[model samples]
Target chain A: MSEPPARRRLGPALLAVGWLVLLLPPFYLSAFWLQTGLFAMAAVIAAIGLNLLVGTAGQLSLGHAFFLAVGAYGYTWLAGSPAADEGLSGLRLPPAVAFVAAVLLTGVAGALFSPVSGRLRAMYLGVATLALVFVGQHILLNATSVTGGFNGRSVPPLTVFGFVFGDTDDGLTVFDVPFGGLERLWYLGLLLVAVASLLARNLLRGRPGRALGALRDSETAAAVMGVHPARYRAAAFTVSSMYAGAAGALLALVFQRIVPDYFSLGLSMSFLAMVVIGGLGSVGGAAAGAVFVTVLPQLLGHFADRIPLVVAPGSTGTGLDASDAADFLYGAALVLTLVFAPDGLAGLLRRLRLPRPRLRAATPQTSAVGEPAVGDTLKEQTL
Target chain B: MSAGIDVPELRVHDVTVRFAGLTALDGVSFTVAPGSIHALVGPNGAGKSTTFNVLSGVYRVASGSVRFGDAELTALAPHRIAALGIARTFQNIVLTRGTVADNLMLGRHTLTRAGFLTSALRLPHVRGEQRAHRERVREIADFTGLGARFDTPVSLLSYGERKRVELARALCMEPKLLLLDEPVAGLNTAERAAMARTVASVRDALGLSVLIVEHDMGLVMRMSDEVTVLDFGRRISGGTPQQVQRDPAVIAAYLGGATDAPVGEETR
Candidate 1:
């Protein structure tokens, strides 16, 4: 059935307001908030990618952090100056080119794992990808020339057409406020998040999305409908990795440093939490989830001293540290989300907005005596 | 509505399929003439579904070949067989979680050519192609009496409507040959009658061959142009419904060796 005119109009108007809100944070927020916002945006991009794999294609990947690391390192190596005395090698390409190349590089890495990803189904593929984290960690720790060993290397600031994202001695002002590196990167992050979401939404609403969803439901049904399961599986993995790569690159830009310790199994788990918390197979859900998961810990840290039962990190207080408190809250949130709202935030929002229109529409068709009969028929049909 | 389509003959010759030590289908042979309704009927575990699986390339046969037109169906992958204008539905409803339009659009997967890149970019031609295919899908939905429920989720549909969704989905592929596995197995009497009428009209209107695996002998005898009876993975009888109905082997197979018991009693 066609949607009511009012409901149809509400979507675009809501989206415009959301975009306006997103665009305003950099102009007024403090550095801490901007940095947290940037991290959330990066997480949003990566979570969207992960959702495409785990949610849409029904493939499980615990190696998302590994791909993110690849993107971060790939960009750093591609754009960094070749410091011969320091024993670090780089292609020294332009940052913009390096950014695109890094994303493609991550895609190639994902493609390399396709033989494994394509053949293995959900949990099996997850276990298989678990190995990539360990392998990536080893390479990151031991590859001293590129990774700088225990001490991480500094990230080169991204420059697009000679305009540096790094802080300048005389910074450019926007709306009577000085836009430094964080502020500059804020816009970049916003642009990336917007583009990433648009592309993902387009993909999900199109032909590939339908095939992938069918594949998730039943491989035999998808096969008979002319969907190549393995091929689509591989494509999903590759595209997801590319998204992870872009996120990693943006994250490196935000952090201004790259550390091997950060790209651990825990990071991969965090990504999984974002997608699951957001809702599977939903682009908007993934973004909402990413924002929640990424921002929660930082928000806790920011207000740790004020919040009850939570102390600042490294304090000798007997209360829970901010990070530990964030972890506990995340676990509780995940459990509650799984138990109460299994469809995640997106589903919950949808449920809140649209109140069983189908049932309502059916009600007007029959008299009071026939209502139970219709309901019974519906119940029997559902069963 | 489906004019100018090249309906192809399906030839299955001595196809044998074995799962481990158990022979699921053993040397079963049949041919479905182009533009005809051919029903494969038998008792439970009579290798009817097994034969459909082999034809759809879900299971590999131990021996023999399945030829659809000039293509050897046995050698190709499931998607490749589908690409050769073959589509199918399962006995169990295997619809994805989405609206009817989404499931029907999946049937048009082979017909559309937008990959991840073009779809993500939403190229102008991609939108044009999607709109065009969606228009056709709507028409197919209307033809199958699902026009009203085109945007309705598959989960909300009645059992009978879901069966029709499956049929409509396969029809969306514009298949020259349609494979339906027990399309009306759990359907009520009225639903079964409607399904039978739709199945007949599909052949008449679309000029496509149908390979149907069903248990309802009444609908099978009434609708099918030819009936192939399978008993213990072997073809026990093959002919017109009337000829097969009176065949002693068919009657014995259905009534468990009671040659005197007419097969009409097994209609339910």
Candidate 2:
């Protein structure tokens, strides 16, 4: 069975638009918007990772920010130069090696927590991971030599070969626009997001994906079907943490400074809200959620005077600030999504009959482009 | 492929299970011969499910041993027991939270060599393995008369169809010893007959031993080569279906009170 003629053209048309947005951002957008887009990209990667763990594997993790801290600090410590005068110590390694190592280091940290994560389920796991934020905070504050204590530390610019992702000795210019840090980092962010998205999609559509889905539905059933619950959970957690690590490194590059206060329980909750608002278990949904969560605050700030009940950040008199306004909107969005649109924004788009790439057939007898009729069944099961 | 033809025997030796001062299984002893169907029939609370759980490694026995051809199964995990060529189906239908094809593929999880990394990377051999596994799943679905429902999520299927999906998944494991708990519990008359046919066909095609705990006396007597009767966690009688049906202890415990058969006459 083949798709209708109308839908046959829609897929490529939509894909071309998506690629155009990714490729043409730095050329037209200002530095502020470019930086905001970079932040959104980083968040998209982390949300996708968290979606796999919480959405797909049915494991709740509130320690996502702790892994992000691990990645940020790991990159700082490995890549930063040793400053004896400032009592700071680093390996002074190359930035590329440090980036890879930091991500792997976060995976190792996640593996270390497997003993706890594998044993706990649902709310218990969430509360247990919550403690990780506190533990991470304490370590970041006390480890002055590595983290520079509460003051945090500066991030070394990521350089590959002779090309630097910053304003350097010889900066390049394209279209009369100086290719500064944000412009160079935009391409880097784009590449990482692409790779991360590719990996997440492949994993979710494969054999391991089915095994995890079974384990989520029923542990006893999964065991009988030959899925080891503890092993799969641990593996999912590790991979998810590695994704967060990659995101954290990118975030650090964007910020150019890492601080202990940035990684907190609030940050973890925001990441959770991002995935829940996007639609759980879908990679594209998670990315959409991440973009919404990351860009909403900046958009609010840009039009702070015009939007009602929202005031500037520093001058607030009973009116919501930019960040607080974003939080309230997302909090309300989360509740509404859970109540009415349980599948979030992605589900809404799907309901509108927008054409989507059918990588795997959702129904056995349907062709590659058939719309899934299992939504009603899913609602009944969940209810 | 022929190596698995020598069906492994399962022997439960004086197995007793106690939970919080209550005896769930009391010195239960039974054996399933190679390539034969054995039935354990009992009342609703006669610990049939408990016995099935003990055999399938879901529960540990308080005393005695479970031997699957020389290897001890009492201490092994459920997945480990499954790896030892023993597979089971849940009484309440524990289906995967995905399509029937996906759930059936899970049955071949132990056989597939691809891990999360290989699958995520879409390695060459991973595609080959997935294709091979899907072919087997399709065959199993067809065998269980579930070919039309292959792409349908199991939650969307009817009760009888869901039961077939469960059985199909267990069969996909290519198990030497199949444990079915109350296989025809909620099925209608036609569904029950169809299920009996599928069970018989599966055993005949695979040449494997089957240990089934069922309450349908007609199906039990018709399908089983050997029958064991249980009453309040204790075995009342063990023999051929006709012998067990004729025994006074079995009659007094369950058959007499439940069925309308006379002492010396056959019911089914």
Candidate 3:
């Protein structure tokens, strides 16, 4: 008998809808709104990479933004200078080649540098990566030859053939309405996010995916099962770095200049907050987190600045309280959501959509509450 | 005839393990014959686990060497020892973070050449390799009576079932030597018998050299072909299971010493 249609088609259907949601929205969004959307999409690209290293491999890396910085600076230098950027040297190559080179160089840097983290795990690795950001900022500040030093570098505007993609991308006449940089970028952002989602989906679903999970579970068990935990962990770190690198390049494209302050420790924390809010190791959660964080602040700031009323008799006031209130709200949202739903937004949604698992039946046999599944039982063996 | 099976072997030469001035293993020496189930039995603190840890590369040997078919195992990492076709199961089961199928597939990790980028991209080669591993894992699970629950996360399985899953994962490595530590500990009579049967079947089917460390006298006697008994960090006697059972030192060690090691908190 033929397999049920639902069984055969469910995966493809989900994949299709996922891409369509990401790609088709630029036509409907205004320029300002599209800018926000594009920014969020870039954040998702970076977050997925961090998720692979921190969430899946259990290798904590706090300096993920350093790789993005590397990519941004590398791309900008190559695009801006004749020597560094082979494409921008008056003999402009295709934008696609420059893009590919940016990504590959970032990946090679990640792979080469990841050996530092090969022997480290958890907090120490995080601290080491944290050191990278502080050290990286110096390279950004003093390396006048490459990154234009602290003044940073202006990347040559991205151009596809002679189409001119950045501020110079000839305006689009859509339904007689014109759109430009932000609008075009909205679609680009969507495409990149879609690509990141697909890559993460495939990686986490199969053999290598399982090996990553196994490495997180137990080094000894992973070894006995013929897995090299250190090797796979290093590989995950490198790929994750590449993702951050790509995202940085996107940022450089968006701003037309790559700056040291943009890829700072604060940015790294922002990325972590996004992943935590979304749910670690979850694709949809990461995107949702990026959207909420990127969008909420602007909406709150605009609304606060526009409101013109104060409830005081003797005091003059800006609606500073309103923005503060929004900040409070976001913080409260993080605390309440995390305290009650530790798995983040995706897990909360999962629990709401499905029945609570029949875990009580199986839990006492092993101490697995800390990890989602299997790991608890496996941990029992390791202990 | 050589009496033992003809395959690559592991030689443990005068290895000792020291911890903070205490000697866990003192000049321990032995050889595991290929395809032969050699039993390492001892008192609770007699350093059997310590020796297993050393061989598995979890604990670095203080002195001497371990040669696996001529490759020196000392100073090499744990995963390297594993890749050399020496796989083991812990006295405690470490199942990993997924379903039974996922756990077993982890065993094929060294065998599989696909990388994170390949898997992430869903490249054709990685996809084909994933499919092949799934089938191999299914066969291993079937051998260990875990065929029916391949989709179920291992956390849901019972203790006996989890142990079986651990064995299934180790088997997936397709090891030359299988080191099992107290494989049937805490099992009920029926469960213990089932576990013994699984052990025997895995050895025969996979053609692996088996070295089991067990304190269960009856199970050890039933499962082992040759026994090396240890007491107080030293070898007391060596013989067939019956002979070891009758050895005075082995009898005293089992009859009087602190054979009770509360399993303790597991490693994650």
Candidate 4:
């Protein structure tokens, strides 16, 4: 059977545009801007997973940071302390093994804790997962022997095939392109982002995806249809956690450090806000939401100082405080998004594209296909 | 997955149900042959729905047993009953929010357990099963007079169309016995007539035995081969419609004192 042109052309067309976006940046942007862009790109990767769990699955998680912390700590422990028991200090291990281990362990840990989430509904699950933030931070801070405690451990540079990455000891060249520091790291970050996005896409399109949607629509209906809702729900959580872990491993490599403070509740809240502002159950919404969220702080921090607010700046009020400003704006955006656009920003975009004038006239006729009204649904079967 | 037994298509023996202090179904005993359309009719609050809930495995029977083919219904879950070739429709439409095709596709979920990993990976098996599921549902839609609107979302559908989709979805399950509760409860005369035809055709086409709980007196009289009447949770009469219509207890329950002013009518 022949496939539609739209389906055939769609992926490659999008990929071409994505390649342009990633490869053309060096020609137009400065180093500092590139640095900020990389940070935002990394954040986008993490937010996509959060969007799936919260938006598509209708699960409420307040412990996304736990996965990131685990990923970072796990990578640093396994990679940087490969032979800790031996006399050699700062023992080195292959970065590939560490990355894989981090993602797997995080998935396992999430599966372990996800059972608690399965038993409870939204509010209780949110509260329970919230404890993960405190617990994760405590473990990272107190496990001095492995995590390196308060001062935080320095993450060794990742080396792929003898090509060292992130602020290299000495600059190196490969095929006329620099394979050191920021340049090498940028390629790695983009690669992770591409891979994660592909995985998330496949996930939301298949059986697990359908199961998640079924569970959300009606638990009783799902149960009646032979779907074990609890098991799939737990699986969604674990899969989402694995994505978070992968993103976190990349983040650790980018920073070349692992710290307890980076994975905080505030960071978790940002991911939540992104999913809320993005349409639930939508992949495009996740990307759009991440872009808005990732770029807003820059515009605000750089320009919001000039744009007057209620509080006077240069006073004790501290209106320009970056962290407080980001929090306030994110909180306000979430409430506004909920009230004005319950379906989220992506839904708002879809609404704009729709033919408002024809919506009503088209409904009945368009839906005339197979809808069995309430009465028909209850039609007495006679033989 | 066939079990060796001579269990009736459905056997509800001495099933008694209570609500607060009132009984909903008092020792209701009935047997449905393998291929028969049994009609249960009564006035409002007749405990017909309670019987449906018990039969479909939604509500646990307070007392007595429900056997479907070779499987015991009481211990089985609603979905399990459905899986065992006994599917039912609700009084209120329970179609999920999606395209008409999607709703029916969900019905085939039990039959199409394509592994999660295979589906996620978009394997050939996944595509094949999905195509088969859609084709079966499309056929059901055509039978239900919904051949045109397969892609339209249910939210955009009217009450009648949505109900059609719900029934089509259930029909796609290929049930041996279909339990339909008040299928013609709310509809215009023409729509009801069309539904009656649709129901009769679907049953005949699939060779399915059905249990119909209905409130429409004319429909119940015309459509059912046998009628069972319940009043205040107790079976008052069971026979052909002519026999049930002529029974004194049935008449007394509807009209008081044989053609005087009706029961509960104000003298003023």
DockQ for every prediction shown: 0.50, 0.39, 0.41, 0.28
Residue A283 lDDT, candidate 3, scale 0-100: 78
Model 1 DockQ (Cα-based) = 0.50
State candidate 1's TM-score.
0.96
- For the predicted complex of model 3, DockQ is 0.41
**Per-residue accuracy of model 3 over B1-268 as CA lDDT, tens digit each:** 0123345877888888899999888888888877888999877898899888888888898898998887888878888888888888888777765677777788887788887667777789987888988898897777677887788767667777777776777788778888899887866566677788888877776677899998777777777888887777777778887776666666667667444322111111
- What TM-score, over all chains together, does every model reach? 0.96, 0.92, 0.87, 0.85
- Second chain alone, TM-score for each candidate: 0.97, 0.94, 0.91, 0.91
Poorly placed runs, candidate 3 (over 4 Å) = A1-15, A81-94, A149-151, A169-171, A305-330, A357-383, B1-6, B257-268
lDDT (CA) for every model shown?
0.88, 0.84, 0.73, 0.72
Tell how far residue A76 is off in model 4, in angstroms. 2.6
Give the best candidate by DockQ. 1
Q: Weakest 10 consecutive residues, lDDT, candidate 2 chain A?
A: A374-383
User: fnat, candidate 4?
Assistant: 0.27
> Across residues A167-263, which tens digit of lDDT does each residue of candidate 3 receive?
6545666776565766666666777888888888788876667777777767666665667777777788888888998888887888777778877
Q: Which residue pairs does candidate 3 place in steric collision?
A: A78-A85, A225-B107, A378-B94, A378-B95, A381-B92, A381-B93, A382-B267, A383-B266, A383-B267
Between candidates 1 and 4, which one is better according to DockQ? 1
Sorted by TM-score, highest first, which candidate order results? 1, 2, 3, 4
- For model 1, how does the per-residue alpha-carbon lDDT over A121-175 read when each residue is reduced to its tens digit? 9999999999999999999998978877677777898999999997876658988
- Number of clashing residue pairs in every model? 0, 1, 9, 17
TM-score of chain B of 1: 0.97
